[model samples]
Target: MNRDLREFRRLERLCLEQAALSTMDLARTGLLKVADDCRAAAEAIEARSPPRGAFAGAVQALKRAPLAWRVGARS
Candidate 1:
């Protein structure tokens, strides 16, 4: 699960960066799909109850991650 979340974050960052530089429509579309997959993975992890408060908080933060991140804005 942790690995999945980590991968999601990594992919999210990569997608955002690529989106910021991508001028081609096909590349942008592909990045959008990758972003969507990352969100879905995060949502799936958020559905589980973490055993520790810190883990719970992390999960919540992941769930609450701002839209700006997807658009390459610092948040």
Candidate 2:
């Protein structure tokens, strides 16, 4: 992975970790938003780069994942 992509992925991971530890719903939501932004940056970088191996397929699957899960939708 390139420097920018790697950094974005790292930030995403950190944000997710923080969200997991968050006690307040609002804080967790904000952290998740940051994580999503980092993921978007990584995706943009990937979109511009040529597809590689299994990683490329994983990225495609993530894109197809349900929006409800990402947004934590509740009934």
Give the winner by lDDT: 2
**Candidate 1 residue-wise lDDT, 1-75, digit = tens:** 888888888888899789879999999989988987887777667566464788778767775676437656633
Off by over 4 Å in 2: 52-75
TM-score of each: 0.61, 0.67
What is model 1's C-alpha RMSD?
A: 6.3
lDDT of 2 by residue, 1-75 (tens): 699999999999999999999999999999999999999889778767766779887876676476437557744
| Residue 40 miss distance in model 1 (angstroms) | 1.3
Point out the worst 10-residue segment of candidate 1 by lDDT.
66-75
- Give Cα distance to truth, residue 67, candidate 2, Å: 9.3
Compared with the true structure, the alpha-carbon lDDT of candidate 1 equals 0.77
Worst 10 residues of 2 by lDDT: 66-75
